[model samples]
Target: MASVSMKDVALAAGVSQPAVSYAYNRPSKLSQAQREHILEVAASLGYPGPNVLGRSLRSGKIGAIGLMMMDKLSLAFADPCTIALLRGISEVGELENVALTLFPLNNNRLVGRSPAANHGSLALRGLVDGLIISTLPDDHPAVLAVVKQNIPFVVIDSPLVDDSFFVGIDDRGAARTQMQHLLDLGHRKIGVIIDRLNPDGYRGPIDPQRFKSASERIVRERLTGYVEAASAAGLAFEDLSIIEAGGLDSTSGQAAAFTLLTSNDVTAVVACSDVMAIACMKTAHALNRNVPQTLSVIGFDDIPEAVQLGLTTIGQPMVEKGVYAARMLTEQLNAPAGTRLEPEQKIFATKLIVRTSTLKI
Candidate 1:
């Protein structure tokens, strides 16, 4: 059957096409009784009103924002850092009355071509008013798409681009501080675990060459900090046992921690994230190695679990970072059309939170 149209409703209600439009979009243009009568007639005729897409296209406003993340959408809810970040973004989004859309670029090696490679164009083609890019690796092809779209965007951590709004901490400095704490505790042999160096599926045991050329910005900086701290203590990148968790979840962390705890020689362990750090502690306990007694563990991103489990970690304000990134994008969006704002950078400070997970050897 043919769909109901505004013309059909107008004809049934003894009104012109413009009168029907005024009833729905410009109610004040018509008398209240006339508008109500038109609406009732339209409802009886099953006229669903104006095309939202058409209206949005004409107005040049979508009333929504896009978020491009490094991992799969499934991890959005699973990762504590992302959860806190989303909470902050959602708070501002509620006030701004804009919706949030996720465009997770699954960088992990898949059986076939990556889905991000397929749907990236859709995101860049005016799907949302603005975008927030979160922790993408260096030279990600998707970023080129975003730049080509000429859309308003804010980058949250990793892969610092020139002439762009960025919000993050000094990853290298924070990691150096984290490792220095472990070194001060008299730990010589240390194992380090990270989520991934790049989007590739490669996992387990980071070779020195890969360590020198880590592709992910945040990971590279943190690894550099660890290497620098170790070098100061008479160690090199090759001296430390570095393992890639292969993923961001606890299962991946547990696997990496197990391998590092069992295969390599180390008294202390530094994980790039609290999730992996907690996994290191769990693996140590399962192997009959007590935390801070037999094996010391340190983690980055002092998530809530770090406090509950008393895990020493490097703390960055995840929620605040998110809030700032959202605000930056919103600021760009709220500006007059075709007005380009100056690129801004906000580097938050990180602190080393000492907990019971580490010991003074």
Candidate 2:
């Protein structure tokens, strides 16, 4: 059967096509009763409203934004921090009547395609009015590619590129504060568990050379913070035990925790994330080590689970980070043509939430 068009709806409703268009697009142009009558008539004629493709072509906008992340789609949803951030973005998108398109840059389904190769293609071909890039590494191929495209974008964290709005906390300072808490508690022996230095899928102790080659900016800064805090306490950097979890999930974190706790005679552990810290706590339990009495653990990103688990952590405004990034991008996209928005860096504060996981000895 032939599809019903606005003209057909207008003819059946005894109204002009432009009047039908106003009923859908500019409802204020028609009275409530008139608009309702037109809609009812159109509905009876099986008209499903406007052609989104045609409207997009006419307005140069698809009424959508892209949310680019470094992890696969499944991992992104599983992550508590990412979920909270998404909630904030969704709130804004709801108010603006915009749609969200997720681009998982690390999705393996691309069939033998390298991240750079896929990112290059995606940057050139992806269709969205603007982008919200979260936690991609500095010098990532996608970052440069997106910048080159002259697309309006907001960066959540990492790679503070030129002409891009940025939103994040002081990672190094937050990490330092986290470590300082342990140090102030007089814990000399410390073990550090990190998600990964890079995306190489290597799970083991991180050496100085490997640490230097870290591609992820946030991870590198957090490690630096731990090192700085230890150094300030007159501890040697070489003596600090650093283990890479190789992944952000619980399994990798548990494996890294087991390795660190079993090999090192550490009195405390500092994890790069709450996930890792919770893993450390579990490992400590399995090893018959009591938290704060025999072992102390500190974590970053005070996720919801952290409270229930009593994990001491650095609390960042996760949802606020998302809300700020989305708002900034939307503002730029909604601006008048040729209006230049000065890209601003929004750095939120971090707090130390000392829970039952740490003890001074």
Predicted structure with the largest TM-score when compared to the true one: 2
Candidate 1 steric clashes: 0
Instruction: Give one clash count per candidate, in the order shown.
Output: 0, 0
Q: Candidate 2: lDDT of 310? A: 86
Worst 10 residues of 1 by lDDT: 107-116
Candidate 2 structure lDDT: 0.83
- Which sections of candidate 1 miss by over 4 Å? 1-58, 93-96, 107-120
Residue 248 of candidate 1: its Cα lDDT?
Answer: 88
Residue-level lDDT tens digits of model 2 in 1-361: 9888777888898987667766764466689999999999998988887643444445677767788888778977899988988988876633246667787877644211443464446444646777898887777777676776688899997877876799998999999998899999999899999998898799999898999999998999999999999999998887889999998888889999999999999999999999999988988899999997999999999999999988899999999899878777765664435667667788999999999999998
Q: For each candidate, what is the lDDT? A: 0.82, 0.83
Q: For residue 215, what is the lDDT in candidate 1?
A: 80
lDDT of 1 by residue, 222-255 (tens): 9889999999999987889999987889999999
